[model samples]
Each structure stands twice: as structure tokens, then as C-alpha cells.
Target: MSSTPDDSTAVIRKTALNAVHRKLGAKMVDFNGWDMPVEYPAGLIAEHLAVRSGVGIFDVSHMGDIRVSGRQALPAVQHITMNDASKLQLGQCQYSAMLYPQGTFVDDVIVHRFGENDFFFVINAGTREKDIAWVRENTRSFDCKVEHLSDDFTQIAIQGPRGVDVLQKLTDADLSKVKFYWFTRGTVCGLQDILIARTGYTAEDGFEIYVPTDTATSERVWNEVLAAGKEFGVLPCGLGARNTLRLEGKLALYGHEISDSITVWEAGLDRWLKMDKAEFIGRRSLERQQTDGVTRTLVGLEMIERGIGRDGYKVLDENGKQIGQVTSGSYAPFLKKNIDLAYVPLSHAKVDAVVGVEIRGNAVKAKVVPTPFYKRPKRS
Candidate 1:
């Protein structure tokens, strides 16, 4: 995921594939605090199209992982996350969020159930330290053990239509059997006990593979994946393409769409908020907010005027009054238009409602539209 600057320290972390990305002429930037590739020689638009049309590989090792286990693991996970982890069976993963007591976000996460007492959390890179500390502080009373395994794995994502085909060449394991949101552990590229999850940020078919953090192993698998998908025109994608793909898919980013100040209801993630679940971290606050009702809401906007509405731009009403702010905005490469997600009052959120976004001191014409501006066609 692409990120905004948060830390100003001179020290910057790099993934194991950092050398490889540099060798491939990827333009590296200080993303949050990591020295990460923002775009490759192929550029952002081409890399985005590669994933939508065929396949593209991304070195997403900067993401953090946590292991929760022991007899009380399920209860511990349920206590921290908004989603009900008890519903997850083996090999299943669900999108969830760890929230504050006041019902705001700690970070959005993917919780995977490895066993009855074993679960893993894939957390946002930018909040690694903060999230780890939050989980530890919150779950200290539970009988489960929380292990920080952020440095143990180099996570890679092979996304787009031909992603499965590229991966199938390296392993005999039936990639077809791994349903969406589920995962399987088996040998991949001669390495044992690799975890391949059928999950991706892109609204296209893909898989996220977990391999050792060692540079040699990481690079070998990375090169093999590119070689395997050579016939399909695979591109080594970077964070620039990653951001646009998720935005077009209507996915949320941490500081942008969600934050400690933004409640689940405000972000419109009511389905996963799981208010019915017993006594999670934010349940009480969420219930109270649900009863009182939320004032502002997350809404999608499309520019009817020429300018691209960038992040932090003021959302305005017809009289040029500031009503809300653009959380995330960009030119949708796939959809071929400018779009944004913003927090606006319910009165201004109806479909086709005319609104104005302040772009460069001018009120640019925009309208409320259905989100996920680009959804992949269903496969037969």
C-alpha cells in the first residue's frame, strides 16, 4: 500500500527485495518510513494495466504479521477485532479492524484462522509498532500468547487474471481448490510449508504468498514468478500501482479513509462492525453511536469538471461552503476518470447529488456516485 509521510527519522527500513527492485530500475521513495519502490521502469499506468489484464507481482514484505495462539486465542481475537472471529473455520481469513474503545480504528486487518487456538493477523505496515503495542496492551489478560512475527516472512502478491496460472507452474498443489478469502499451506517453489492465501487488494483474482524473509529465497521466488509469468507480460509492480488499484476497487487506506477519529459507521463498514458480537473492544461505543446515528458518512464522488481532486481537498456545497474533506482522491487509470472518497452529510450523499470539491481554490463540479468505480467482471 502507498502511504503518506509519518516519520521524519533518518533511518529507513528496506524489504529483502529492495535490491532487486533497485536493479530493475524501480523508482524508490520514502513511503511512511520504508525505502520502497513507488514505480518501476514500466511506470504506474502500465503496471496497473498488467495486473488488470494479465498478472503483476509485488514485493509487499513491509506488511506486519502477528501470531495469536493458546487455548483462549479465539476469545482474545474476538476481544480486539470488530468482526466475529468465531465464525471463521480452518483456512479462512476475514477482513476486520482493531478499534479503540471509542469505536475508532486502530488499523484495518486481515485475520486468518490457522487452527482452533491459532490465528494470524496481517496488519498495515505504517502502524506496525503501534498495532503490536495495542494488541499486547489489550490482550494481556487473555490466556493466549501473542507473538510478533513481522520480520519472519517476505510476503508477495501475484495479482490479476493470470495470477493463478503463473503460480500453478511452481507447485503441484491445486491452486483452484483455494477459494477466495481462504488459504492453503504447502510447498511452493521447492520450499516447504508456504502459505498461499487467495486474497488481494485488487478487485481481480490473485494470491498472496508467504515465504522466508531471507533475501536469497525472496529474490529467487520473485524472479521465478516473473519468469513463470513471462508469457503473460507480468510486471513487477510498485506501491504507486498498488494505491490506484485499491482505490478503484473502493478499498480503504488507514490515515485517509479511516483513522482513530473515524468510527466504523462513519467509514461505512457496518457489515464488518459486528455489533451483535459479544463484548469486543469497541462494541459498546459502536452500539451507542448506532443508536444516536452518525452525522457524516463516507461517500464516493466523481469529478464532472476537469481537475483531479487530490487528498485533503475541501468538499464544498453549492454556495461554496466547506462541508467535508476528501479522504482519498486520484485519477482512476482503469476507469479513465477522476474520483474521490469523502466524508459528507447524509443529506448530500444521495446518488447523483451535485457537490463541489475545492481543487486549487476553485469549486470543481462533482457528483455523488456508486463506489468501486471499477469492478471486475464475474468469471463463468
Candidate 2:
């Protein structure tokens, strides 16, 4: 459970599992007006390492879930997003982004297709309201219904190599048969109406389970998963570990890696943008940028100096001239080194290109390396 206040004076909203988080002695912090746990008693490093070597669970209930349905759902999704939603088969999910008319991101989202006319979108928590409003405003031209389901569901992420082993004990679904990016509706921990998806933010084989917001069901599932995972050295992780895990995998964060000012081309996500498909929002601008070429591109950086590169840190050329800025940075627990993602001029994005990162008012040498500092081995 969570220890945050619930009175009118409180500014943050607590998740249904807030009390359970508090009971587990989690160190809670204000994450964009949500009282979320940053770490547990074992600390961030321990939690992070657990996910890399074994299994760990995360409370990601703050994520937004939006439903788009009706006869024109496919068309509505296709018009607003850059990806081709028509290609998605039932129970399939595609990683896509919504862009503004200026070719910059509105948000990066995961599009999950439930059926021919039903689609579920998982969006960033901080931008939930704005994304919902954007969807509603632009989707009015289509014959679809957009519903915000963020408040009606809770999400838990079970990650790492042993993720399947632990979760298989609780869910009746055939864990081994769920392919990556696919989802199935099944009973979890004897509870009905749960959606289990073979998807995760961490660079590992995992599952993200979505359950109803009913307090009793939420508590039961959370506790039962913990009990089932105890033998696998499963630890309850927090946002801090989640950040490190995702950073090692070079995953994009909303406000940091990709934001309102960052275009999809600059963010190194052009493959997901289907230019051949019918026109969508930002299509013209993105097409122009593609033809002209983007000035700056996102790249991965490895620190050569002792200091750690952090967000907003200036990326400078060899002569100390500002070239770009770091978006996401951290000391990756799995890699055992300081790594970061930054946007630099196209000239400096080559592999092994040396750049300087401003850390604590001093210039620290860093090398532009290949992205996804870490990648999981293929399962045999």
C-alpha cells in the first residue's frame, strides 16, 4: 500500500494498490502527480538486477488505457497514428506514435487490436489527458467511439528470464504459446476478465497483465503473484529500476527521449512511420523532413569519464561547442557502465564518434556507440 494523503488538499492520486505498496515498505515519490514507488527495501540496484537475472514485478497502474471502437475504429486509428493499423490481426499489438501536424510527436503509444472494430491504446501516464483530448478532437471525423479506460484498470509488469515460469503458475493461459507483442484474455490467479500481453518495457521476455480496478481483485492478484514468484527470487520493483532497465534497452521515454519538440525522424523511429500508407497527421511534414534530411538524430552514448551524464546535459563537440543535449542517461546495472541517449547533429551520430557531455559544470568525454546498449539473447 501507498502512504499518500487522500484528502482534498492532496495533489497526487494514489493507485488502488497504494496501500499494498506502503505495506511492502516501498519508498514512494511524486511521479507526475501520482504517488508511485521509486524503490523498495532492497533498493534500486537490487530491484534492477533482479529483473535482469530472475524475475520482478512492477506496479504500472498509472499508465493510460484508451479504447477505440465502432465500425470506423480502424480508419480512425489509421488517420491519427503513423502506423498501419489495418495490418494488425486480432490479439496483435503494434508500437506506434501519434504526431502533430508539425511532424513532432504527440506521444508514442502501443496499439493493441482486440478485434476488427475494437482497439486498445496504452499511452503515457503524464500525457493521458492531452492524448485523450487529442484523440477525441481528431477522431470526430470518423464513426468511432473513444473511451478513456485509465481509471478502470490496473497494470502489473512481470519481467525477466523467469517471468514466464512465475506467471504460468497463476494464470490458466498457455504462457509458452503467447508470442511477443500478442495478448490473450484469460483468468489470472483465478480471477476472470484479465488481459495478459507478452509485452514489456524491459529488454527481457515478460508479460504485462491488465486487470479490472476492483480493489479485491487487484489485491488478490498482486499478492498471489508475489507468492507464486517467491521461489524464483522475484522482487517487487519500482520506477527507478524500471528507468534503468529501459535505458539499457534504449527504450524511449515520453518527455525525455521523445517529446512535443522532437520529430519521429530525429528520434530514430522512422521505420514505424509508414509513408506508403494513406496520409495521416504529420505525413506532409515528415515526408518533407525525410526528403530534406533531419539535421539532428538520436544516438546512444557511453561515458569515458568518471562522471554520469544526465538529462538536459549539454552534448558538445570536441572544441566544446554545443551540438545537442542528453535526453535519457543512467548507470546501467546490467551493463555496469554509464550510458545515455542524446540528440546530436547528423555528423556526430556515427558509431564511435567522440563527444563531450557537460557533467557538473565540467566536460566529460563520451563516445557515440550503437543503440540498445543491451539486448536479450534469443530464446532457444
| Model 1: per-residue Cα lDDT over 210-291, one tens digit each | 9998889999999999999999999999999999999999899999999999999999998887777889998889989999
The clash number for model 2 is 7
Worst 10 residues of 1 by lDDT: 1-10
Candidate 1's TM-score reads 0.97
Report residue 352 deviation for candidate 2 (angstroms): 0.8
Q: Would you list the C-alpha lDDT of every candidate in the order shown?
A: 0.92, 0.91
lDDT of 1 at 250: 86
Candidate 2 residue lDDT tens string, 110-133: 999999989999998888888999
The TM-score values for the models, in the order shown, are: 0.97, 0.97
Q: After superposing candidate 2 on the true structure, give the runs of residues whose Cα lies further than 4 Å from its correct spot.
A: 1-10
Tell me the lDDT of model 2 at 283.
97
Which window of 10 residues has the lowest lDDT sum in candidate 2? 1-10
